[model samples]
Target: MSLREIKPGNHGYLYVNSHPTGCRAVVDRMWQQAPEPAGDRPGPVALVIGSSAGYGLAATLVGLRAHRMRGLGIAFESAPTERRTAGAGWYRTARTAELAAEAGSDFTFINGDAFSDSVKEEALDRLAAGFGKVDVLVYSIAAPRRKDPLTGEIHRSAIRPLGTDYRAKTLVFKEGVPQIGELHLPVADEAEREATVQVLGGADWQLWIDALESRGLLADGFRTVALSYVGSDITSPIYRAGTIGAAKQDLEDTARAINTRLKGTGDAYTVVAGAAVTQASTAIPSIALYISMLHRIAGDAWQGTSDQAVALWDQLVGNAELELDDEGRIRLDGWEMDADLQAAVRTAWDRIDTDTLAASADTEWFREQVGQIYGWDVPGVDYEAAVETTVPWPGSPSTDA
Candidate 1:
């Protein structure tokens, strides 16, 4: 092993390497902060579909450490290579397995393409052999593309408006300085629009549920949630009212369809989550700028992905009751979308520019949060010293994936 100073490979959405130490530290903090279990009976067995990073990983921690549930996490991640470490999610899953082991909670992780029918079958087989039945399933997959299992066609998702061009203030870095810059996202074409829906929409989610249900893997009163986002006015033109929005609407529709198919044996919901710094969120236009402002306005009170995941579990499984909006979807973004908060964010958004970006938003904090996603800005990690570049993904049978 040699000392490696990993940095952002691009505008900051992608990184060259991930630090195992920092990743473990971040997971440890989330596990420590998660609320204790609310029920005296044994917790539910859960299968978190995207449980490696972001909300999926947080939900895994919530289930294993908070609710004391047995969990099986499925994610697609790059394993450690000769010249580079594994992706941040890989390290996170390995560490999560360790934490689960310490707590005597059963946790299994599979790293593979979740959209593949073979992978779904593998997950189902694992569920049958180990978990027996799943009471909870969290669909939190975010990908730029997907390969259709039935047709063998690859569908790629795009971040673009529907009919009209979208111009917005997006976060950009000039010579390593965070700046508010204008982004002009053109409307996606017909084929691109359909492709976006194919990749990001509810089709894959429905497939997973159907596979599990067909195998008699879903326990009675089974509950599943697909994480989603609906942006504010400043971002709606490029986000909520864009191609992504259409896909999210499909996701909600799929939830209703699943409910109908289950015939009260289970429930499905599309959970609208608050904006957080995730790999997918960073790539979206205007999200970085908006999230920076959210961080600024809610300093010390800002709820990160882990906090949001905990709150979600509390409502979904803890003592709290499940609250739904008019559309029957869980609206966990309510706190982030408070009238006063959005007003403050809009005021900052209006004034933000390269000159006033730092003052209008917590640019440094935003950058740090992004760095922490790949285990860079985490506190007390000795980045200067040589660290292992090939951290083993504990007990993962699909490490080669």
Candidate 2:
């Protein structure tokens, strides 16, 4: 089979195989922009949970290559080979290791379930010998469901509003047409909110930190952050004020707890990033529609996942004072929630429909961005070249992929 013949999988779920050319392009972009370490300043060692794609993967790159930090990544990803499709995250993790090896940087990737106590223990085990004194921990998990290791209780998060139902125009972009329809989500009750928090909240984040500190694994000035999103009034009802919002509120409270516990030694905070058409975000009905409309209005300003991650790395590592909001959360969604930009987006949101969607919505751009997530839209790669699928997993040496 030819590489160019590899297309996106069903409903934007997986890529049949890893495209070597496309995968290389993804990591190369990070290396090209990677910064050098300063003299007299050794890079900080970092531990990145959910370090497979999106901000998690980008943060790994920034820490290991851009900031010259030693990095230990924890993620759950699959491997690609001649007979089967591997998720986009597989390529993201593999390519990052390949790049790290080329530069002779210390980058260790452990492909295990990160939300488990055993996994946390494994990380602690490797901290002293593999990489010492983790100075930063970046939590970027985006699982839809999680099973607690202690209780064995499975928790699922639903994307719906609280108090009252919500109705909005949802969108799905296709090859040439945009499918726009009204999506209504019934209000979630107390039980659903609790489940969402159990799965998506910062409990696990706090748990990992406590485990690390208990073992004396964290170095001085240690800091941890979990990414979040609280968008405009347009998306507030279904997003910022919904089941997901309840979970985020719990995350904020957890960050406060962590901060209070670490008072003089370290700090934990939640950073709200910009709205992007992420693989995870695409799963949310109303969010996808809003982002399509947003891209249409902010054509030049439609920030993608990498944009948010890269900017975040620069700000965090640039040696400047961290700029935070009233609640003490880092605000990285400035332009995304800009009053004037959102006013324009609100106008577009009110008029968006299937008929107007093709012309008025940035479906084409949205489609391309989605494809890029799975390493499909890269240019100059001979997708038709006779393929080789021998890429190895990050920690294993069999090269089954």
* Overall lDDT per candidate, in order of appearance: 0.85, 0.78
Q: Please write out the lDDT profile of model 1 over residues 178-244, one tens digit for every residue.
A: 8778888788898888998898899999999989888999898899999999868888888888999
Reference-based TM-score of each model: 0.95, 0.92
* Backbone clashes, each candidate: 0, 4
Where does the lowest 10-residue lDDT sum fall in candidate 1?
1-10
Best by TM-score: 1
Q: Pairing residues by index, what is the TM-score of model 1?
A: 0.95
Over the stretch 106-163, how does candidate 2's per-residue lDDT look in tens digits? 7788877888888888888888788878888899988888888889998998888999
Name the lDDT value of residue 267 in candidate 2: 80
| Model 2: per-residue Cα lDDT at residue 287 | 77
Which one wins on lDDT? 1
